[model samples]
Target: MAMIHDSIVKEDVVEHKLGFYPRIPADSIFTRENVTARTKLRAHLNTPLHLATMENKPNSIALLLSMGCRLSYNNLDMSAIDYAIYYKFPEAALAMVTHEQRAKEVMALRSDRHPCVTLALIAYMPRVFEAVQDKCITKANCKKDSKSFYIKYSFDALCPQLKMEDGNNVRRKSENVPKSQNIPLPALNIKYSFKFYQRSKLEVDALRLALNDPKYRPEPLCVINAMVAHGRVELLAHPLSQKYLQMKWHSYGKYFHLANLLFYCIFLIFVTVYTYLLMGSSENYSHTKKAAKCNLSDPMTFDRENKTEKNNVFNSDFESKVAMYTSTVAILAYNAICLIREAYNVKQQKWHYLVDPSNLVSWLLYISSTLMVIPTICNYFEEIQFSAASITVFLSWFELLLLLQRFDQVGIYVVMFLEILQTLIKVLMVFSILIIAFGMAFYILLSKVGPDETGHHLSFNSIPMSLMRTFAMMLGELDFVGTYVQPYYKSETDILLPFPMPTFFILGIFMVLMPILLMNLLIGLAVGDIESVRRNAQLKRLAMQVVLHTELERKLPAILLEKVDKDELIEYPNNKKCKLGFLDLILRKWFCNPFTDDAGLDLVLESSEDYITAELEKQKRKLRDISLVLEQQHTLVRLIVQKMEIKTEADDVDEGVSPGDTRVVPRWSSPRIRKKLRTASSFNK
Candidate 1:
């Protein structure tokens, strides 16, 4: 059956992919053959969840979900969610993510972590981190541990605590460990403080599944650090993320953040002026010295041979030189500040700081800026200087857009643009295979019968050339004289169509399958996905804004880093009481203390669990009421059928049917007739 002609099967009622089996939302058991355990429905389970995603009906995903079909089967397992996401089905993926979140909330009961944060920790963070943590004991126990700055600092922080609790048991793990290590431990700071946040096995498993299974969860927005490492404003949206966000910094500490921006702006201004000096005017190289180096005592001659000495406008203009000098100084200062700021953020935020796309984009621009400096210092290779500066300047605009994302209105659209572009590229990538196959096919056919004796191969000369021709043809650029006439001209007015059969088939297929038919397919897929894409807009915007804000917040003046308020610092999962009293300090000495501040120290988790439980209970009650109503309606329907039967029996008697004749009506009261001796009279009444 699987190998049957697809065309013949399409002629059947079920082959229309969109809305077939309208009543049966999920696939039925395909087990008519053997009717044994091996031939069960489980083996061939198909689901509308799979259908909805592949069809780009993300809007329909939730609708299908409401139909109560099993989401996880061999055909559509948890990874299906990721497949949807990878193919740009954001809404469908969102539905899957939300379902996973709900399931976790129900299962975990009172787990304090946000689903998103839990997800990020599991998905975005290196899987290697767990292994790294496991080996930290051996690393810390190394004989030369004290030689490293971080190891020494972290040991000093961990030494003050003598006892620790692991679940139901309390262990004095800290007592046996060295208190004076020198290595700069990966998770520590210059302040020599260490706060170990714990995650349960269940949470870790959930996160792990989220990364591997499509149905498990969505990717953390732009792959930022988990909320535990640092904070993004977007994390504030979810209770779990909010907890992590609160644990991290709440605000930019100083006006120096503004100063850094101004510095970059100053750098850009200088770069623009330098670009103008290099490329803005013509014949300005006349006054410059003709030397490999910019500084020399010689007459400047810039022509075809000595092009390197050309465009030295800075040599002639005093202000351009001043701008050049000032810009160089600004660039150096900005680079140093950015580098230091990033390092500070990494120390405070942990490994998550490096995962941000915005940071990566900034790094590219910074590197470009740094490269431009080499040319600037030598005061040579003006073209290279101009080229590098232009690229840096363009990328800086993107960085600006990233920064502007802190503003909601602008951020939302920019986020939409980024996602849309990403999705479009993915869409184009799908069609690339067909494009390449067609291009290769066309190239082979044309190369076989390419060009006249004059060797005028219009597009058949090379694969790239044929690909461009095919692409142009797809865009309605078919050149008869150039493509066909020049290549296959038999004589002045007569021309033999090269590989007429292949040409016809190739062109026909390319036009029909790709440009005409396949083009519509692309449009349908994209259009189908638009609503699904729109569904994720808010979360996507939040994710982008968080990235931008996190970057800016890190650049605040050094003085402001120490002025954090205790009130603002209090957030979920990571909340702790300030140790103001001597007793508070004393309580921290033993990890075995029953009233450990780290455990259940906040009411938020408990309250959130209660709210979720109450909501679930409320829904269950409503379903119970609905079931009762359905039962009553069923009883009413049975009574109506009985009444109709009794009426029909009476009509039969009036029509003078034979007395011994039996009515073939379905038995409604066989037991009632048996119980009553005076059957006719009693039944008539």
Candidate 2:
């Protein structure tokens, strides 16, 4: 059945591409004399509009709508706009809203019990969204329909149901009767039958399934990500949205997140201590041995016992091993916790889980830690083990810092650094080609140059080395005289000669292009966007807060969730009058966001103020438009009254009544009526 539906949709797409469904002429469908007939015809032809919408044919849908086709649901209880949004055809959905002032209807339509705004959010149609905002909720409306802000349903409640059909057979006859006259006919079943279940999985499986299933969780996440990606964080700042965020945060979100951060800190400490011990062991081993490189293949030189200083770290291997083992246990415990979290995200977020950079780092650390756990590998390959341990240590701490970024207090700084880092990467990408060109040029020019004064090989002797040297030069380490003054060996004469003029010229250009030009350009670019970076960083921080809180809500236990969830408007304190615990009071005093010292309530209030201002502006524009319409109507009315008076005067004069005589006038031409009309015209103006 699914395959059939897909094939039909595809065929419609092909026909649309081939122009088989061209726009119908309005004259053929509707009479020029009567609009009532057109309305009746359009009402009957709404099925075609629904069909066009289901097929995702935006042009056909628009054409049908232009002919006066109305938006309505078919027998399946799903409307055309619902089909468009459910299938994620943005053009098809936008066509409906952008035409014939149908945005209100589209916004009002409910798909799978969720407001059209919910699905429309995923579509990210600005015009469609704007239409919904036209009727912005005021204080009165918020009080009246406050319950509308909270959705009392599970995530799967938003998923559209698919209908399936199957043949049924095998009839068993059983007749119901009174207590004294019961009868039953039992026989052998002749055929088989099947039952179709709409939703077979448990409620717990809904989120997990939705992660990978397009019909479920992805739609919700898509709306969120779309807003964030487009820098539409202001949408998330809606009063209802902020209330939801606050509810989630004040519930188990803050506690769970803080606990998780604390655990990670402990893990980092363990990793740090483990790395310190390893480094200390290596350092002491280095000090104990003579300053001579030993061949790895020789067993005699590899003996550590023979060349040990009295205070070598290996002398206390017993105590060191004990400490290492203790730290390893703690690290492993934290790794287990991390593994559980990763598994949960994988099951509930699917591919979305991997989008986070920290997840990748955690996986890398996980693998490295697992390899390090094997005693044999660590003992036999000490160098490789140490290298892996070093990376693991760095990543563990870096991941902790990233986790800390979820907190708004510390997040701004991290966000600013990320913004700058991104700018730096772009700058480097643009200048990379120039740097490589210089590196290659230097390698070609100075490859034949002999060792420098101390008999050390010149920096530009090899291609890789030349690139490193060129990059270093860009950082103000120009060894210009040292590099250019080197001599090239003459093989035949067995003597050294100085470099030619071309080398000096190349050095001068390198100095100009790299250290002098590129360095300053990078610095200036990084500094120029500091203000914008700070502004964007705040928005990004809010977006992160939204994502974090939403995810926390999803992870909450359903039973406890109902208890924690707020279904009403959150009334924030106007001032800091409420008392707090000693620890919280201290923390709030020191760690609150500087820009919003009143505990995020100020930010919420600001958002609400913006919303109120926008609503007022919209109302003002509407009133102005209405006033213009009334002025036009008043003008038409005055013109009709003037024409009537002119005819009346001409008739009165033709009838030979004295010009001074006042005959009984009709109420329509009375002074009172004229005066009222004039007053209305003036008021409208």
Candidate 3:
């Protein structure tokens, strides 16, 4: 390598062809085709760039480039530029990148490489699951352009394995041995060693150069979608990625939808089960089994009358406690994940912290659960505890309803409900007036009639009571005795009143104005919204989904939401080692295990050194015997040819033809033949 520089300064011993190309003396035994062009510790297809890369010598790379070596040309496996990058030779890679332009002019291009966008998506996406055998699409092990990439370390032919045994890479029987350094991917248009295309400056600069060259600018959504799909969360550092990732909540639509849907199902299940435990199945109220009954079931049954209730086989109380313990733990764990996701949402879309309904529901749940903690721990105010409990149940179901907004079919139901509710707001003023007037009339009449026999007002003790009764009537709770008579009665005696307490007022005015007129009129007005909602289901659902998508996008980690250039992150994983498949795992466990899988080359290397002296002598002896046999054969052939030539000359004389007219074929001769003849003649004597 130093010879070029050495000769340049010392012209006395230097020679040149055409005053430019270097020339060697006649004594030089090696030529251009020789495997070793003054090399050591090298393999087949070895070149100066490969040496520079392996040695981590940047100066050597520059030297080789000056010597007219191409960095981006097709190397045996990896082009030099890709090899440098894979080996973490950044300086070498940069140097090659500079020379790439000139290389294109010299070498005929074959194919193109995948741009940053395509590779980022492909690299990060999870491998598709296959149930049975997959013949291709492997990260390692399987042969490449193969006759079997690499050979096993076994006793075999002495010189070397057949050349055909190895392909572009060595697929050694030991799958872990990484034989191929090749990155000649099909997606690239392979000009100037297209493998280096991934590191091209164009991709990440798309945003920077957007104004100058519109074509260079990728869509904000495209960068985001690619980043999400490829899992290059680190790219959030890019300004464009940061801007779009935070705002474009609906980016990565399908993947985002699926991810949230899965998490939502899990959250719903745990929340549902936990809510059940808190409401009824908890062992805290086991003694009050009658109190233990949830609202969904009949009132708890107390068996105090029985001197002792026998324990059942299942010990229902203890089992219920166990269920409570486990469900509580699971709920806590899942809730933590939910909170983290929601917090991430707030970070990505700052406005979502206040505007998103799901976020609002999550905050409500947090507050309610926090409020219930004291009541639950002290074992008092079961009503307060269950009120919070009720909130969780309502929120869980409501959250699911919001998720339904994303479903194209059932999404229309959400639209209809919201539309009807919004339209009903217009009638609220009229309804409020009627409710107030009716309540005031009832209060005046009932208080004027005085308390019933129980010494309490059943019809109207206050304006609040009158209002509550009137509102209940609107819901068709028309049993005035249940609503007004029972509460004030101390033995059904409170019914004693002038003209029958609440019945006359309920019949004459309350029932007529509340349920019969106002309540019916409210429904009649909102009923008009259903047809309008049904007609525009698609657009309405889309709007709802857009809203939902924005919220769900906030749940993702900001890292996943960020944009990274595909090229920068392809080799992001430093190890570059691929994980093994099921078959490989099994084979490794059972078959064979070696210290270091040198792809079988170690055996040849070791054996040649160990037996070098003896092996050379043995080969020489074999060659000598073959040479002697060849000399004897040549002697016989030479004698036969000479006799034929003499016969041809005599035939020419008999025919009276000129000697020049005769023709003779060539034959062989050797001094070794005469030496062998003499040795044989002396032996016969």
Q: What does the lDDT read for residue 531 in candidate 3?
A: 74
Q: State the lDDT at 43 in candidate 1.
A: 52
Please give the distance, in angstroms, between residue 405's alpha carbon in candidate 2 and its true position after superposition. 2.0
In model 3, what lDDT does residue 580 have? 46
lDDT per model, in order?
Answer: 0.47, 0.57, 0.46
Each candidate structure's TM-score, on Cα atoms with residue i matched to residue i, is 0.43, 0.60, 0.40
How many clashing pairs does model 3 include?
13
Report the lDDT tens digits of candidate 1 across residue range 368-403. 887876766766565666677778878877777665
Q: Write the per-residue lDDT of candidate 2 for residues 1-685, one digit (tens) a residue.
A: 4564453444344434435455634333233332343334445344666767867777787777766665556555677876776677777776776565454445445544344344455345544443332223222223323433212111211122221112342111111111111111111100110000012223224434434442342222344455566776555554333433444455456667877777778878878888787777677567545433544566575565445533364457767767777887887777787789889989988988778666788899987876665553255436667777978877887787777677777777777777778899999998899889989877766666555422233676688998998889889887644444434433233222344577678778888888888889888887877778776775677688767756775676655654544323323133223445564554456555222224434443337678899899899979987998999899998899898864555455656667678677798898899999999999999
Ranking by TM-score: 2, 1, 3
lDDT of 3: 0.46
Native-to-model Cα distance after best TM-score fit, residue 603 in candidate 3, in Å:
66
**lDDT by residue (tens digit), candidate 3, 433-471:** 877777776666555454432334565678888888766
